[model samples]
Target: MADELIFYTNPMSRGRIARWMLEETGVPYKTEIMTFGGTMKSPEYLAVNPMGKVPAVRHGKTVVTECAAICAYLADAFPEADLAPTPDERGSYYRWMFFTAGPLEAAATNKALGFETPPDKARMAGYGRFADVMNTLEHAVSTTPYVAGDRFTAADVYVGSHIGWGLGFGTIEKRQAFVDYLGRVTDRPAHKRAVAIDDEAMKIAQ
Candidate 1:
């Protein structure tokens, strides 16, 4: 028998990113929809993720949290999907994945909350300046067809989700490079299916 795969998520959260990666893997898994301040904080879910966050995955006895980690794990777990990067692609794959997960996420959240790092204190911040992050991101996406170069890998799933969400929510700048890169990565059946599932889940939650 195979190990069971379970996905915990909320439609209105970053769980959508993990959902897309799961769909891309074409694996059979169970979805557990959690609501904010409710099931998410329950002891049951808390045991699975001490942070009580959605988008955690339990494969057999192994539990993985964080969207970036989940994407990487799934790609490696189901290599038949070919989402993991090749040897030469590892540099860019891990680079952009961590970049988006750390710097991009922090900068965008701070900007949306109308908080900016002081020029003098920018040196203390991991993301430095939001504008610098945006410019770097633009260069990253514009320089290659995909973040890992020439192919769509798990890195794309993680990085592209942030760009897509940022663009939709006005957290990311409206650069032509960003718009083009987003279009290129998301024009796939897996992405479409993920969106549809989450959209329906949102309606149910409402």
Candidate 2:
């Protein structure tokens, strides 16, 4: 194998992010679908990702997990796609990318679980509060077409997916800025192709 990319995922999981990134890269890769509570937790698969998560990829001897990381990795790996930032843009690109991965994810999950942060304890929360996180995100996207700056980058791939999914599932409250940002980033042919593939797979699985 001369550094082939092997994608392990389930259609319904965060693997959708990686799928979108892969499609954006226009990369050819083999996909292995694993069912929850079965092959996903099996010893063989656990060896690949101890977390038993979907959206794990093996590129040659390298194995990468986490949706945001995979998106950033693919962008850097496929520079011709222009999904990565130049050195000058790296700060903004990385800022929002990690913000979504850490604070945004935590805030959304906490809200979904109905875990409210007491006022006094808000300072201790990494996301401060879901409302604050949402406000900050809305502001970031409102300032630019993409998360990082004037152009679309890997940061948009990661952050946009979360916002889009959050809006679709009602995990994140509706905001005009979010709606507009999601529309702009997700209008690409790559995103549509990825959605079509996953939608078909989801229908089949159902």
Candidate 3:
């Protein structure tokens, strides 16, 4: 049962984040590539994730879904990877990680689709509007070397990937803080390997 980790993802999907985390963990897992509207919709894949989403992982009998959850889970599961934050650092770690997954993701997607939250109804919005989310994120990265201070933990993997992708695709507004932080995270050897593998897979996919 040593290599019982199973990773289900598509190169063209958010699975890249999990892939990067997997590479960082140095875990030997199986990759099951799924296609949109094809095998991804099948009953088999649906059983793994009723949401029928990519980037789900099965660790022995435990199944983990959502990119952020998978990354965080692996950090604890493979302690040798040293991706989890210390007890003292857990506050910031969980804060920014969930922030990125929740508010940031929603705000960015809504903005990308040309949807704007009413200014008067700001409280009704999860992110309180896109600019607020970006400003909060900028402050987070600008003040620390990583999301959770000096250490690069699973939090950075989730948050940094969002910042990187947001900047690249013009979804999130670019800030110098985001630029610097992305450079720092993307330069990691594990991140590079993950990107290379996904890039090749994407090329072959096309």
Best prediction by lDDT: 1
Candidate 3 C-alpha lDDT tens digits along 1-206: 57499999889889999999999999898988888888889999999999988989999999999999998999999999999988887988899999999999999898789899999999998899888998899988888898898878988989988998899889988788889899898889999999998988886552
Model 1 CA lDDT for position 164: 92
- Displacement of the residue 140 alpha carbon in candidate 3, Å: 1.0
The TM-score measured for candidate 3 stands at: 0.97
185, model 2: CA deviation in Å? 0.6
Candidate 2 lDDT, 57-152, residue by residue in tens: 999888999998899888988788999989887998999999999999998988889898898999999999888999999987998778888998
Cα-lDDT of candidate 1: 0.94
Ranking by lDDT: 1, 3, 2
In candidate 2, how many Å is residue 72 off? 1.1
| Total colliding residue pairs, candidate 2 | 0
Each model's total of backbone clashes: 0, 0, 0
Ranking under TM-score, best-scoring first?
Answer: 1, 3, 2
In candidate 1, what residue range of length 10 has the lowest lDDT sum?
84-93
C-alpha TM-score for every candidate: 0.98, 0.96, 0.97
Which of 2 and 3 is ahead in TM-score? 3
